[model samples]
Target: MTTSPPASATPALPEPTPTQSEQYSLTHGKLTVGDYLPKASHDGKPGAGKCEWSSHVSVALTSDEIGALAWVLIDSVMKARFGPAVQLYDVWREHTLDGTTIPEPDRQTIGSFVKPVFGLPGADKKKSKDHLHGHIGEWLWHLLTKDNPTVRAQPAPKGDVTDSGGDGYTIYETANSELRFRLWESKKNTGKGSLSTSLNQAYGQLGEHGQTYVAKIVGAYAQASGEGAAELNSFITEIPRAWTQGDVIVGAGVTLATHRPLPNKPFKKMAGKLPLLDKPGQLRGLATSIECYEELADTVRRYAWTAL
Candidate 1:
């Protein structure tokens, strides 16, 4: 009864500001997403301190050892088109540029060539999880592991006593998975540089549980560190920039088999939960299929060796 006219109704609270999209240009001028360029056009040349990652080839899989991953997947709703595989070389031979071999992987040949199940599941699923999983224990106990390639034995010049040193390797997706292991090719000949393989020594470089859901690229790009100096140069400069470079919206140019996956927005908003597969390029960056797998092999093949 005391107050004159009711105080002027307060203006309705301004609608909350919209989120800055990572995929498209922003509507309001002030905000924006990272780059959305193609993977090839973004990642610039890595300098000495920047940690360059070049290889003759790369292969990605969604697997827990026992070889490349076997995802129960297909490619029908395919939208973000994959670039055609550059037909410069035969994919298989290209993958072997670093002297690695898949061998004549028919059933018989593969059986003999397989070193051992190692940390992966056995050809038999139940047995694999029970036996191999147990044996791997603390080391391979990560949620999203990868079998990244490294030189089994560092190749020597001519035949200087022929020291058969090999590359080491390791798995990542969580925890100390970035570890490397060195092993000898000729365990009996224990010379100074004896042949051996071990996990890469970068385990401590990342967080025990890094955020990137790298466990997805299983369908294609077996995560081979096999890009050639130049081809790798092409990728770093192009894709990373598109995926997450400067002003433009970059593609993140991540491979499908990267241990980390991209993040998703729409799903999180509606479901009120964050999903590993919800990330932008999370499920994977590459398309998966028999052909694409082979194409990945081809791409690595071409990148590894120039003549091929």
Candidate 2:
């Protein structure tokens, strides 16, 4: 008879081999993603209509929601580059105002606020994935779940930031007082490949490295001040054990082709094999599929140019 391997002898998960990336040049005042339904046919017929998505899922593009998202993105960017407790308005004014005595930001100033995040040369370059991933994280924070500034501010680095790991993390209290940790990962497909490709990449990222990244960031924040810093710090020290002993939830955000229809049934069938951490009898396996216009980045830039 064979004996079971000891805990230490158990192998850590393997690293994820993400798909090859493509590079695209950034265009000014252009958007690459937005509301658009992909072309689909029922029984070999082509048509246009509302694509049925998972229940209760929709994107908010109203002025109010866009403005809120802008603020959050700006604040999160600053907090990640600098630290928490930063006043984003001041930072925006500092960079855009250039010593002017403007009490409030105008349209031009608003564009300036987002330039670092979206305006820089090649910010949304063809191969870049950070912008899409970071934006999805922000979208989930505001639209689906309660806000967590630290996770949102996790910095969309211009380069080499994806390796920074732990796209996002949050803590929740169960009815019985047990703690559960939720982690998120995102993938964007520029229509060069099927949506399934991006979804698979996201699921792989979460399974391979989500826990380690969360533990690292949580440990850092735990030493500082925040809503759950102290508790997170203690949890980090315990690590693999802490994660296994308690509940851990994983979320994946996939950006798919907007021109084609995505049926929920087949999508679920495909995702069934993912190594999600959502436990039995617990809310787990959170995901969102975003269909973007061909010019989402341009649209966002125009919005910022007009709104700020």
Candidate 3:
């Protein structure tokens, strides 16, 4: 009879390959994208009626995987930046392109370099709450678009600070490849009141300032270059007319911090809120609920510094 190998001599199990859902464009080399948020479920039959919306459960990330997802989200926005951050990002990108894992020391160095820009591990309570709410809302919207093959979204805001314009912008390509633009507003419910309070606020804000918001996004694209920039700019010029013709889509998403059961049709009641967007293919909504929301914010902050 043969004896078993000693612990040190036993072969180690190989790491499991990540599934398609767990992978992202930035998750190359040894970087693994974590399953932080659950697979989103359509609130109802999307596209069967007027508005489209989806729902998500509480985030499921421990300290183990939070950092990986945090890094991926940050990297996505970093694509639209310049200077030192881009330099650091390029270093990481080189490793991805080379199909090699970043060394532990380099990982720590890069993490430390970018941590302050993101306002991670924020000390001020109010600032931290606002930061988490705004960033997470924008991020969720960005992720939602990723699930739909026909939609291409602009990058989320790069940092913890919220901008004065719309929370997101997306281009939805129809079956024949005609592009339709969507302006999105995202909010978080931190008060003791209902999620509708936050969503209603988003609705009103979009109704009042939506045009100005769209203008800002279009202006930002004016500085863009590269192959498709001109084609994209042409589409941008049509947004005003599109808005008048009811071809543009307006969307609002809210993140609720509670354990209570959510409404089966959360956005149906708001059908009349934005009349222009009430019709088929014109309005979109998303509702994400999380337990211990503040705790998750703190955890995201802490794990962002994990490599350091």
Model 2 collision count: 27
Query: Which residue window of length 10 is worst by lDDT in model 2?
Result: 16-25
Q: How would you order the candidates by TM-score, starting with the best?
A: 3, 2, 1
TM-score of 1: 0.19
**Residue pairs in steric clash, candidate 3?**
none
lDDT of 3: 0.57
Residues 1-308 of candidate 1 have per-residue lDDT tens digits of 67675588765532111111101123322111011111222223422212212111123322121111110000100000111323212232233333343334332332221212221123432232222211121111111112224322121111111222221112212133222121111111111221111111112111121222112111222333553434322332332222221112111111111111222211112111112212322211121112123322222212222221
Per-candidate Cα lDDT values, in order, are: 0.20, 0.40, 0.57
TM-score of each: 0.19, 0.52, 0.68
What does the lDDT read for residue 100 in candidate 1?
A: 43
- For 6-40, candidate 3 gives per-residue lDDT tens digits of 87896754322212212532353324222455545
TM-score comparison, 1 vs 3, better candidate: 3
Q: Model 3: residues >4 Å from true position, as ranges?
A: 1-34, 44-49, 59-85, 90-128, 158-160, 223-229, 248-261, 305-308
Model 3 TM-score (2 dp): 0.68
